[model samples]
Target: MTSSGIARPAGGAARAVTRTLSDDPLGGTVRRTVLPSGLRVLTEAIPAMRSVSFGIWVAVGSRDETGPQAGAAHFLEHLLFKGTNKRGALEISSEIEAVGGETNAFTTKEYTCYYARVLDEDLPLAIDVMCDLVADSVLAAPDVETERGVILEEIAMHDDEPGDEVHDLFARAVYGDHPLGRLISGTEETVTPMTRRQIQSFYRRRYTAPQIVIAAAGNLDHAAVVKLVRQALRGTPLDTDPAAPAPHRSATPAVRTRPAATVVEPKETEQAHVILGCPGIDRLDERRFALGVLNNVLGGGMSSRLFQEIREQRGLAYSVYSYASQYADSGLFAVYAGCAPGKVDEVLDLTRAELARVAATGITEAELARGKGMSKGSFVLGLEDTGSRMSRLAKGELLYGNLMPVDELLARVDAVTLDDVNALAADLLGRPMSLAVVGPFDESAFAAR
Candidate 1:
């Protein structure tokens, strides 16, 4: 019932609340506790920093939606910003921005997060505003209509951006026709017909105590955070587990086809946008580190193979590279390029060959070492920011049940071997490729090429 206690969660699902209580010497210790109502509080104190960032993470997103409620999770995210009984949308914005702080929310396939960042003394205020947004949004009709238009425009913007469009297309090509294939923002047609009642129903079901994670980092006390979470979450009851949907069945791999050198809409833009992708491993896969290293050597940065081959060696494109994106259940490893329209085929062939070469030849010791070094350096650099640390902890709590200390993750990254990268390249990038392209060309040219 209090901040420090040991109680077994019914059905053994409550172990996430049980963590060693110790002072985190690098900054502040991470502490976990469960409220009587079942909410989980995760707090990390970084006294060296002057600002605090805390987030309320709900373990639900697009993957949870059924056919009719395809975009309801994202819809609820917008409605939460509309207003609460005590504050309107404008008031909420003014209040947060007034403090020289920032507030925002995002919806993904597996989670919806609302967070705020402010000076240390303003932690309470940030917490209060986030609590209001998450648990008390009014979802008024006027605001609903207004936000619908805003979301529609957001969708249009993404559709018009070739790079963004290619990523979406890649997801479809990789995941098949499952819910994962659709964009997180949903289509305009889907958003247009959504109603307030639908948003409320989805919100009430998914935003429950047991499923929520409250994480804070910066100058703060763990006990104070536990108190705020307990008070704010007092009467919310947990929803019974929803029936698990049938597994998303992917269609048989499509034949490898050259991406159509075409633009969906001809634009008077100076540069042509392009994206290439391959099916990737899931988040929990052991090969994640290898894939990350592969991405680093292939297209992660200036030193990556894709950059060297596509830009530095050939001077064919201004930008070109590869990276990996993983979700709760699956992933996509992709390469992207922006070049002159005339250079489309040349760039595509170069990218494809680079991918194929890595798969066949495997990475050398120097290449693997640099990839690991880059991955390690980026991970360490990310921790230098309080906000990034806070996010890392919050997401880790949601995904791994406990935070893997920075050292533990880096050690794993360091342990990756050349053999690992080779197998990863073969399993993921080397196989039959699925193509997605957008530019001033036609599908036939890609198929024929």
Candidate 2:
């Protein structure tokens, strides 16, 4: 409740409040408005852009699901578009498409977003359709069963993709049975048995006004956007008693992880998928910038140490990279390689050597500079579109509870020193790591390797 986000009463009626959060010469002006219903609307008005991306972001994801409600969040996302009191499923899609626009939704480990990208002139239409689907969904029984079959098939298709499945295996290896380790799409056991009533209850209980944010970017007026959102949500579940937006997810009690263990899934695949990693810092960690620099040097790109040594020099693997995934209180840093079955050990050895070398002696000054450039260039380039800009606004509020200026973000990266990267490497890369492999090997095959 006491955070950098919009301050409001924890209970009772909250008055509508608006403020200009930022004014950039090139990025347009960013503004925020918190409605009496506790629904927060944020916008970045880039008049030169002919497209506007509107989204309704909920602060709920697979991480918030109970065991019985494993995939409930994602399932609910699909059913919302099935129908609402005001429009049917076809109407929802047809209306948006009719205007040369596109609308879609996705669920993540920490949040869910339902969004539409339309011509600037059709901003009002985008707001209404997006608002209607989120606020007034009628989760019919028939629709639940239909989507059930679709999701099961999706799960099956995912299983066939060993490349993707390896990441899930690594998550399980790290978090054990924690919700963070579970798949965003609940498995068949959970989805097949899920009932309409159960999902409906989950929806009403979780999607509260205080837990939602509406974000838009592109050519539009912030005030007009807020008004359209209010009108669209006039008589719905979200238009209830007002309260302060819920604080960012609590990070007090850190998420516990499993001991270092190697898990091998023996499947007869052409190439083996492998990930070697250990627990990393959380999103709030002060050393996150250092970690970013280290990750880039380690395996973030083609010129990265791992890529240069493994793929370019020996040609043992076609794909090799390292990444870090951060959550509210816990995170992961891992290296992935897809190689021929016979080359798995060599690949692992090379990867391990690179990690140990970096851990023992930090990267050179040249590597650090290149890493910084890559980090900064990628970030600035990613925001070239309205959707990315809109996402930045929602994530700032839902995840961090404050919009950090672009300059500040760049400065943070710029401030990372050689010692900072080296210190983080010595600490993080030196930690015990777990191994996950999806390949033609027995369970005992990887215990020693």
**TM-score per candidate, chains pooled:** 0.88, 0.97
Best by lDDT: 2
Task: Give lDDT tens digits, candidate 2, residues 160-256.
Answer: 9999999999999999889999999999989999999999998999899889999999999998998888889888888887577788898879999
Task: Report the lDDT tens digits of candidate 1 across residue range 284-382.
Answer: 678888888888998999988888888888898887888787765567778889899889888888888878888788889999999999999998888
In candidate 1, stretches whose alpha carbon ends up further than 4 angstroms from where it belongs are: 1-18, 21-27, 235-270
Candidate lDDT scores, in order, read: 0.75, 0.92
Q: Pick the candidate with the highest TM-score.
A: 2
Q: After superposition on all CA atoms, what RMSD does each candidate show versus the true structure?
A: 4.8, 2.1
Candidate 2 total steric clashes: 0
User: What's each prediction's clash count?
Assistant: 6, 0
